[model samples]
Target: MTGLIMNERDIVVPGEKIASGMDYLPGNGTFREGEDIYSSQLGLVGVNGRFVKVIPLTGKYTPREGDIVVGKVVDVGFGMWNVDIGSAYSAILNMRETSEFIDRGADLSHYYDFNDVVIAQVTKVVRYKDVNLTMKGQGLRKVKGGKIIDVTPSKVPRIIGKQGSMIKMIKEGTGCNIVVGQNGKVWIKGERIEDEVKATEVILKIEQESHTQGLTDTIKNILEGKGK
Candidate 1:
């Protein structure tokens, strides 16, 4: 008979037995050996039908093609801007990927000077290092007049919640324009600075307690209580 050795959302480390029997299959961050499934890394256990997986609790962001990310312009070079996307490998945004056309040697820094934060999409990633970014799409551009915060990349989904319900609630409660990046950067802008700070606290709370059950209801209560 198949049996779960750990509860769903349980914190597990590598080599921890998660399930027993052939009825279970291993998914991401898990491995199967001798008819048993084991956690392959430190993460929260998630079970769906017969498949068991572990969602990482902490990790660096790995840029993937088609991911929307927030980046800081670190340097301006010939026809390209080097961006730090909170990853080991910096990304390149060529002038062609920008929203406007450029003339040769036309002062690239005029477009994206150092330390400017922008929301862009990853267009290509070669060998996990050569990442290319684009800023020609909707909602992609330099973000100004907002506070940017970083969280553990693994908790991004929990911060967003299902169908963006969590983020939507936060935005409504604080009356802030918040943008969450796949690279774990969150930008919050509000008419009042207090609102921005509150939104930041809520997002950090979600990141901290993401593995807990009843998280949605809990977060909703938090927002409502704070609004009063």
Candidate 2:
């Protein structure tokens, strides 16, 4: 019965019907018809037992409250910084949220300059989609001593894997500390230069083959080969 339909991780297009009957339920990126499930966007199919879902292959990150994101400072102004988070609108990080003491006349560049990468959390998102970011939290600050990279925002989950098992493997294997932002910015830091490069390769590979099955083992082998 299962083999009659599209396999897991198969790329699907919009309005393409993939499954039928009451045995399967539609999940993300899919919608239910009379007795069939159809893909609502370009994505990869996911069949975990009886639950059917679609993993989006391409999309931008939409801001949401409490979303931790890595952003680049693109512009600086009066008491605020504009961040590019790969979205239509740039997120705003105000100095008030950055420190307890902020003088109105003080130069903001002393804290964050143009092109500085920052890991921040979306404290508030207005109806107009203006994202307010804050760094006053544990492990949220300017990125230093690490390599920053970008990936498709939609692929972040696959990079994270089930219960964060995938990323954990990459970290343990490469001996790198990794921070993943839901906005698709990743910061990797390793004790050794070679380890950081290895970790970066693993991350990019995972992003490329995120829909493939058995990816965990595949990534492990790549990391091991680099270690040797």
RMSD to the true structure for each prediction, in A, is 3.0, 4.3
Tell me model 1's lDDT, rounded to 2 decimals: 0.92
For all predicted structures, in order, the TM-scores are 0.84, 0.78
Return the lDDT, model 1, position 98. 94
Best by TM-score: 1
Kindly give the stretch of ten consecutive residues in candidate 1 with the minimal lDDT sum.
Answer: 55-64
The residue-level lDDT of candidate 1 at 221 comes to 93
Cα lDDT of model 2 by residue, 156-203, tens digit: 888998999999999999889899999998999999988889888899
Best by lDDT: 1
Could you tell me the TM-score of candidate 2? 0.78
Residue 174's lDDT within candidate 1 is 91
